[model samples]
Target: MTEPTQDSFPVTPTNKIRVAKRANYDRDTLFAILDEGLIAQVGFVLDDKPIVLPMAYGRIDDQIYIHGAKAARMLKKLKEGLPVCLNVTLVDGLVLGRAAFHHTMNFRSANIHGTARLVEDEKEKYDALVAITDHLAPGRWDETRETTKKEINATTVIAVTIEQAASKIRGGMPIDDEEDYDLDFWAGVVPISTSFGPAIDDARLKAGIPVADSIRKLTSRR
Candidate 1:
């Protein structure tokens, strides 16, 4: 597939970054970051207080989905079609510099601004749940039991279109002053890695049931 250029999205004031060179508006970049992110911090206001809630999220095309109990305050407030800000960040490394002032971190972050609407249709909600599950576990959706009517009715899902989004990325070694470089200090980057641990069977698991191949593959890919 052809990659969309960074100029595809408009450079609005809310989505613009002070360091323009570090900002990316490419559709591909935004989608990549969103798909890789397991959690998102959703920002919104309720009762005159601004709050940020970390939630599990899924991305399909240009849409992001987050689900929770129907009675959840955050989900109820968000379904009212209020403006929201969603943020996802992936820390790549710890950038250490010779000087304290020059210390920094290497990371990639994406911020999205838009309004979320409730997803009520049965098929769409089911698909959204599948997407969410697959985001957490690549192929576990099909292995689990199907969603029942009672369960479906108890849950609420919100869909947010990628109307305005931007990604900021930083990498490479630390930047230090020339004079500081000559001082007796160390400077380098400590890379960060992510991995899934081995699966532990449930205490009540049925006898002789082996770990699913999908789970093994998922953990192995890390």
Candidate 2:
């Protein structure tokens, strides 16, 4: 077997953790959490007010790509080289404790801070589109029809370099007071996961066309 490639993220003021111990600067850990998540919450300032909106994204190495309609307000603002805080999180489970105040969640999350740049080169734009597609549905990009120039021109893609990023994870059972451990309340972890269900055929699918093998593998894993 080949050895896994490793990369490390740099610590910066924006990504430094107060708790210290829960912070991770390892690239592998950050990438793993990012790959498992589909949506990213991008925070940026608009007219001196901070805003955060969830959007779909794809990652290639240390760069993350996000796209939207050409006229999207957020994308337009991001293209101006504004500071961005992109965050992705995966909720693994809910930790129930005897005391409501001790209840918490088991999660893996990454916070990436950088400036957003517009992707303009044709080749890179096409590759970014493919990455986004493959990230959402692995292997489906090749099975789909080719992208038209008009379609590509109408969409705007922004690339955010991972200049400063960090990962934080919390797992296992909840921490409760020693006296609360003997309480009559039930306490444990309730696991949570996103799973693919049975594939649904498109209404317009040709009768002779069968389910794609890539989709079969995707659903099977779930």
Give the alpha-carbon lDDT of every model: 0.86, 0.88
Off by over 4 Å in 1: 1-7
What TM-score do all the candidates reach, one by one?
Answer: 0.93, 0.93
lDDT of 2 by residue, 3-28 (tens): 22356766666678887767888998
Model 2 reaches what TM-score against the true structure?
A: 0.93
- Itemize residue pairs with steric clashes in candidate 2: none
Q: Model 1, 13-49: lDDT tens per residue?
A: 7888899778888878878888888999999878889
